[model samples]
Target: MSEVGMNKRVMLVEDDLDLAVLIQDFLERYEFTVSVVSDGQDAVTRIIAEQPDLVILDIMLPGLSGMEVCRQVRQQYEGFILMQTALDDDIDQMLGLELGADDYVIKQVQPRLLLSRIRALLRRAAPLQFASSEQQSFDYQFGALKIDLTRRMVLLYGQPVELTTAEFELLCLLAKHCGEVVTREDIIQQLRGLEYDGLDRSIDRRISRLRKALQDDAKEQDQVIKTVRGKGYQLCIR
Candidate 1:
């Protein structure tokens, strides 16, 4: 029964009744308000209407696929979406991220590990608690791009850019170290509090999504976020 989970609403979209009940019970023990919806269409409708703090969405479901539900709900809802996939396939994870999923976990993942991931996502979604006055006052501007650290908002050419929580965090990380290469290990450690396994493509996927939101060409020579060969990424301060 963790106090951190208190008052937080989590909607579980797993279709397996037994599994759903198990997850719901486990999360409830942690003091989170849990809701279960087995159908994708129903999940979308309820999620839009209820607007839970976070959605634990499964890829497979009756009626509508999880991908469709994510796509449709994302158009209207801005809540954190944590996708679940039974397969450990990269395509599923990448596609889900591209479709605005904030994060994903495999169905076979341990319950405690799932809880930890959920906590991590929720922490990121929460308003920043700055540790220093400089951090509290930090904001960045590079040409047409502008990022307000305090407001957690990004503007491109005076237009608001819609970004997932993960994308915004990654962009802020890069912006904070503008013109400096922020390594993969540094990014993973700072953002996830985990070691970079060297195989995890989630960061790359997020960078791709961020680049798209920033209207930066990833393949071009003069990219806003330039990939430094074996090094990580650098935010070119134009």
Candidate 2:
């Protein structure tokens, strides 16, 4: 069944016709206005022109490749990016995150789960849209790290820091519980709507990447987000 009054826009970049059709059909049913581009070059051009709310990108695309597309678009587009690809290798995943992808979903994902991820990203993007005046200004300043929730922007030492979607959400979650330990279980549930089985290391990888972006030297003194050995991660800014 299609959702009512959900006018969120999405751009889907895939070379596979069958898969693209399947995704478009399913998302349209849920009230998303999706635009399709089969090649990376076209994806970049349209993205710059339209500025969709979210972009679903394929890693392997004709012409420029998905990685190239993401790199180019990141320079101008500030919308959410979800990388959906058939290549599920660790290197691919790491590259996607390093290139500023918001989320990475391997191909053959259940439509329901994919839809949930889409909804989650959109929700994070507009967290305080419906909140009261007091709640509307959602900004967190911790030492050199200043987070402007309304603009979905983060700054480190007064310089802008570009964070992927997942990284930003992790920061937000920690800030909401500032000075409290946010376990891995809670992080997985909040970001991916998945239960942490104590085996997945994706969250840890994200933390490492985020630390580098925030200039937190893990080898020296852990201050930004400190690890509690076995418990979880805490955002400590002093």
Candidate 3:
């Protein structure tokens, strides 16, 4: 049964007709509006024109590859990206995250689990989600970046930084654990309510995208998010 019915749309881009149909049919049962596409180029156009609530991308396609699509969307669109692909290689997973994919799911996995993951990314996470509304909202500052949990918006040196729900949640999680290293397992358990995955590069990818949104250099910056060797990550809270 499709659990995510109306009020939201899903962009599904996959070249395989059988798989596409299966996924579309499954999602539609719950009330989700799904726009199906065959390749990455069309996926980008549909995303810009329709602005879906979330995106389900395939790594291998006829043209424009999913990585490029993810990059373009990260630059402009603020929405969740769930990559459903059969590729299980580490390089592919790493590339996907480097390009800003929120979650990666290997094909043929349980649909219920995928649905749970989709909701996890789409759902809001923050200090507000953890606390109450009546409590006076406060701002979190780290170098040039500012997270207004009250407003659920990010600001960098006074400039507004747009983030998809997943990206925002990733940021909030790091900020909440500021100055401490959080492992991929810890992040997945806390954010997605699941155990660590062998292919769980989604959290890392979300963090990379958050850095780009905050204009932090991945190779040469420690102001916002700094990687700890053999550890997770640390948000340099100021």
- TM-scores for all candidates: the values are 0.64, 0.65, 0.56
Ranked by lDDT, the better of candidates 1 and 2 is 1
Number of the predicted model whose lDDT against the real structure is largest: 1
* Reference-based TM-score, model 1: 0.64
Candidate 3 Cα errors over 4 Å, as ranges: 1-6, 125-238
Q: Write down the TM-score for model 2.
A: 0.65
Q: Candidate 3 lDDT, tens digit per residue, 29-108? A: 76788879998888888887788888899888887888888888787777778886686565676677668887777877
Badly placed stretches (over 4 Å) of model 1 are 1-4, 128-206, 213-224, 229-238
Number of clashes found in candidate 2: 0
- Cα lDDT over the full model 1: 0.82
lDDT for 9 (candidate 3): 83
Higher-TM-score candidate of 1 and 2: 2
Candidate 1, residues 22-61: lDDT per residue as tens digits? 9999999888999999998999899999999999999999
Over the stretch 77-108, how does candidate 2's per-residue lDDT look in tens digits? 98888998685575787887778787878888
In model 3, pairs of residues that clash are 2-30, 5-30, 5-31, 6-31
* Rank ordering of all candidates by lDDT, starting from the highest: 1, 2, 3
What is the alpha-carbon RMSD of candidate 1 to the true structure?
Answer: 5.8
